[model samples]
Target chain A: MAQSNGTDVRLMKGNEALAEAALRAGMQAYFGYPITPQSEVMEYLTMHAPEHPGVVILQAESELAAINMVYGAAGAGARVMISSSSPGISLMQEGLSYMTSAQLPALVVNVQRGGPGLGTIQPSQGDYFQAVKGGGHGDYRLIVLAPASVQEMVDFVFDAFRLTEKYRNPAMILADGALGQMMEKVALPPVGSLPRSAAPWATVGKPATRERNIVTSLFIQPERMEQINLQLQAKYRTLEKEEVRCEQLQMEDADFALVAFGLTSRICQKAMELARQKGIRVGLIRPITLYPFPSAVIRKAAGQVEAFVTVEMNAGQMVEDVRLAVDGTRPVHFTGRMGGMIPTPEEILAKIEAVVAEPSLQHA
Target chain B: MKEPDVIEGMEVVYRKPQTLTATPMHYCPGCSHGVVHKILMEVVDEMGIQDKTVGVAPVGCSVFAYDYMNVDMQEAAHGRASAVATGIRRVLPDTYVFAYQGDGDLAAIGTGETVHTVNRGENILMVFINNGIYGMTGGQMAPTSLLGMKTSTSPYGREAAVNGYPLRITELLAQLPGAYYVTRQSVHTTAAVRKCKKAIEASFRYQTEKRGTCFIEVVANCPSGWKMTPNEANDWLEKNMFPYYPIGDIKAPKQ
Candidate 1:
């Protein structure tokens, strides 16, 4: 409900807004390493965080150290966060997996750049599979959220912290280099108190009244560990039902629909406008939650639309999810740019037009 | 020396520190982790900081420290316990925090974390256990393994040309301006155990003084890993380990 106006909004990069909003959302600590594009998150926080009381900002020695520091802070019952980019995030997968098994709530930001391994600093959604499909080694999922704008980047910091507490699982704001670097006017969340019950399993000290709280991911006993895994899976099931977030535009009698998210979705929004002007009857379904992924809406769209086209900054990573959502009800087509390339609106528009022309491209 | 008079119907000593849990430790004979864990717990209990103490366990044989130490603990991945301890100490500033790590975990794989944590002056105690071999992972040659030492990984006695030299990590860390106390002691003998315990308590005390990181490296012996009996390991350690990782303080805070 908070909106940016002349008084409340100031044009800022997505990374800056994310940092500011996290502080406002009661983040007690920020631990991170400097990495390309994403480094601005820590930079902005370091510059502004001293103004906020009780906030601890630390520049970690490495991404490995940063994420583990987040693990420690999260275990200590602090509202903690960490930010990094692709190769850096790769370095953090072990720590992330530890947090997952521990079931600690942490807000992590990945201003992703190109990488199979340290590919480029340019924006790319190559990490979509990594974010939603458990980049860390575990039968777990990071509640992945894709923010398409500076506003959502700001807004989702609050959303991410809340969802993390609600499920007690790590939540990632999967933005790419463009969203992190682009400047826009954004309204930040007001300072609010996190509910005490958020981290019931946190390792607060053993006082006279409360028992000692131990936070760990190591479950050596096989049977009990399996039970914990099942319990985590159950919570994930609840999240899939409850946390599927998406935005639909111009679906009224649309014969063709475009599916994308984050930066690609914003590009698709422009492509949709261009397609509508050219009478293509194209619409958009912007998946706000990449993990739970708005599959129900896509299923609904599949009933009405003749075909679906997915645009992404990666080489057809998310198209697989769209296919599963449509489930052979209709045809699906994918077009993408990889290795740090961002596809333009005209390029996306041409792809959508081509999908509409070829009837046999349905199963693709 | 005479034993203190005992009072009837009163337990003079708790026997074990209250901070040590009832669960039995899985450390092998002469591994020194059990002795280190016991002494650390004793220090925590004696300091009356049991309720506010948090321990970060490293990924090695002692990763299961959480099961034995009564205090709240978080298990860090291999070589990141210092960073993890730093985070916890920052959040719970008033809480006494320490990281328990092995030579391979600290001196080798975690060298960066161990050095930088000391360099950053984080107010946490770092308990480094330098037993010449990697005990948990089948007695591999550790960074602190002696120049002529032979183990599973180095079946042919370690040669300086092939394996480099044993690392004097405490000496390396002593040069850091942020390190308030960098001491090397062992737990192989009763006298050494007492000195090691004193060093640990001193390091924990410095956390409250708001001084920089206190690194206490305990040069211990691993009998099973070294293919020696407990007494033989201690004798071998005295003959070989001490010459390389000599006892006594490498650096100390200003008096």
Candidate 2:
């Protein structure tokens, strides 16, 4: 096994980059099932696990089993992760609910494809609402990171683990089929950079020195369950306040804005340039953390921009959040392609032009 | 004093193991879940692995097995205990891990996880408590419910046409190569209790050898769920359940 002297660079697929980055970030175990657009993640880990001793990678029978395995490993104080595509992720919602209720920290990578039911193998942001708005039962939030490129995919693996462990909650890297399949240069984190932290609550067997550890989400009493829900809500509030992150691209004197994320955000950046060439004065706001959403930034921009156009590869999922942030002050228009369709810059630019060219907006 | 009379000459016949916590279990009187919990903890206590063992509790009557078992424990979702044990065992390979599940949890809802975990040869003990009914949910029919068993769901007694035949999951699991040790034991009799204790101890020992999955099916009784008194439930189990379940080892490792 060759040692990593910090600079381990490779042109890798987005899913592969995430897997390598997870291993480099000192992930202790990975349990996953095969799902299209993300199968390479486990494949890469299974092939490279020999190079990284002390890491356990197993292909589980199903997504439900994979997530529960993650739940168990995380409860046992292991840095663990699981990855799957959209439909498989849907199957994991029950386990995710259990994980969040137990307050176990683990990483879930959703390489999203089109959805509703076995939608398509192509990339889609249809799961944005699912990721941000409690896809599972119960009141819980997963710290969601949207990576637009393979490099961001590599970088956010460490960030997701850090956030999940720091807050003692589950975190998700919401990638799409496009970003998962695309190849780009990524600088993997140095080996052994992220050491396992001490988990006082982990069920690692109770020595006499400490009280026995019990990991569970079951609260038989209604008052006790309410108290746990209150605690989780409080944590979510802190996440919203402190963890909101986004890229404000060229908003310095803009009259209009384009709100997008992940792969669609890259397309929006191109559309912004196209709109700018037409004297539209459009800027792009790319949300990196979807859960602790960059609402404050979008609200601030709402005061300056005449209108906002949310571009997505789904049927206007994130547009709802953008509208909520804009708060009816400005018309937040939406243009999207659904069922595994990718929105072109020209199509998004047309929507932006129509929103700006509205007689009401022209008068304002 | 009355307490001091012949105290020194008395030999201890029975005592609650230290591994069984002082927390009184919530199981109904004569429910065999408590009995299984007692002997399982006894194994952990006698083996001196209470600190080295981790238990995964299922969602049925023993959902709070963590409360009564004084080891590091985790409560899993309804049927996912075996999968949860797999995660724990894989992460801490040397830790003695076991998943305690019930009839519905193991044979029905969690059958996939149970089968796959065994098939993968996950080095853990799976303690399945087959009460032939869903005890926690008010006496619903379980997959292992006898063909003519009556329950809340099976009001007219289970019929193969409507309810399907009982599943012999323990025997089915024994056929898998990953199942290194598979056995069926009961706790209705003093002799049966001893055999069940031995089975649990053997499963824990097999875990140390890294052989494969060790499974113990305790043909337990649910007095409250069956609407019977403790003695009646025990008698019923002996007469009716044993004929079908047949307490004995189904598979064992070669010498």
Candidate 3:
């Protein structure tokens, strides 16, 4: 029996949860185009915008327009956000680079679908490289948060806003079709619980008290541009030191480890449990923040585990990061299903067993 | 203490608008961007909306517009100024928002944003500076480049067979219901400068009235891009560009 607190704990699709969280997190404006697996985010915001006074929801003409709108609203010092899937996210790379260059704080949600070119509307982690590698051009990094569940889909939205504002850079909530469309119980924050602090640097009609502020990414002079790039690199280093978050499940006395993130992490967890039932020592490392890769944890675990097996929905993206973290102390194995294919726990378990038997595959 | 309006025997009949920043503009000599920037800032000054105006600067020659415009400004990507202005205006509806773009930025790469922004009736002012060439990138042929005109990209004169027809985007946008006021003006002479100033002033007023989108296209010239002296460029503009892109209001608000 549930308490009648006006459906305080309600089952919600991950996309809906993300939209609800944005409103509650004091999102001032939302500009997005309709894209697969994430269009519900905009639809929910539009339908419920009336409940949140002064909240602006607009369906932009295209992803390019949507991203620029985010840039514009962010420059005006509003808590703004944009959501899109794979193909749409590709259109936003230029805008993302500009936002990062200007050091503007905003949120971008990528509910990823299979892609190389409009591949499928199904779940896949192919965008892991694109998200963490500064998908846009130039030397820039976005604070990428991987939410593995519907609850996290709601929670990371709030985290993204806070982190982006704190660092004065953009942040991304990287989910997938599975997490976006799946339904689960989530506790949405109370309305207006999170009030964003005023951004003094915002260009909202400069007052006489301060010199007018300019939000721009164009530093024409080569020397000046280099200086700006250095400044951005320094900020990214600080983020790496302070914001690396991950979940280590049942690592104590484990001889093997499985590393993954987002939806794949959930699947890996099930596989770990299956391996444990077979009298095998297996652990799971779920990286919540993909940008500041949890290298230290994986490196430390490498000394304890004989081998690591990475399971993903992509051809093999995050596996590279896993291999880099291991640093040859132990062999790192990878098993992936591409083009919108989900690896069953049994398949992942088999890979773990194979890695455990070989311990060091010559090609690993 | 504020300086006296009258210094010595000089009554100071004319002076730079306070809304125009002290930063030295990087525009080439005889570029219409400087005049347009001055006139637009003058409107911001005279209307006393300097503190309530947000400007969006486009990528072309005026990419450094934020350095010259005293008001809060955002420099948008090439051709994305109108979309950026839409974001700013929606967030701060009370603020007077405007986007300044060039022929290449507006009529070429940003045509989609410009058309859609006006179609949605975004309550902002869009200032288009059409020089018929890409000034910042060293005089490439722009979408608004007159046919038979030779540019870097069209070295052998723009042929109708090779290059598409010059786009009359201003007239095309005027047909949209969202365009509350659409006009084309220039700053070639004293009278033209005054008319261009009035158009900008009215555009801001219409923005405050929530009269959809107010677009003003200035048929200007680029001396460096056109490979001509400043005076030659102005003369060329009046003699050549005018015949194709006439100066006057193409659309106006109803009483």
Span of ten consecutive residues with least summed lDDT in model 2 chain B = B1-10
Per-residue lDDT of B48-149 in model 3, one digit per residue for the tens? 998999999999899998898999999999999999999999999999999999999999999999999999999999999999999888899999999999
- lDDT of each residue in A32-94, candidate 3, tens digit only: 999898989999999999999999999999999999999999998899999999999999999
Error of 2 at B75 (Å): 0.6
Query: Which regions in candidate 2 have their CA more than 4 angstroms from the true location?
Result: A1-6, B1-11
| Tens digits of per-residue lDDT for model 2, B1-255 | 113324578866667887888898899999898889999999999899978999999998899998999999999998999999999999999999999999999999999999999998899999999989999999999999999899999989999999899999999999999999999999988899999999999999999999999999999899998999999999999888889898899998886
Off by over 4 Å in 3: A1-7, A359-364, B1-8
**TM-scores of all candidate predictions against the true structure:** 0.96, 0.98, 0.97
lDDT ranking from best candidate downward: 3, 2, 1
Tens digits of per-residue lDDT for model 2, A72-110: 999999999999999999999999999989999999999
| lDDT for each residue of candidate 1 in B181-230, tens digit (9 for 90 to 100) | 99999998999999999999999888999889999999888888988899
Model 2 gets an lDDT of: 0.92
Candidate 2 docking category? Answer: high
Winner on TM-score (1 vs 3): 3
Model 3 residue pairs with clashes? none
lDDT of each: 0.89, 0.92, 0.92
- Top candidate, metric DockQ: 3
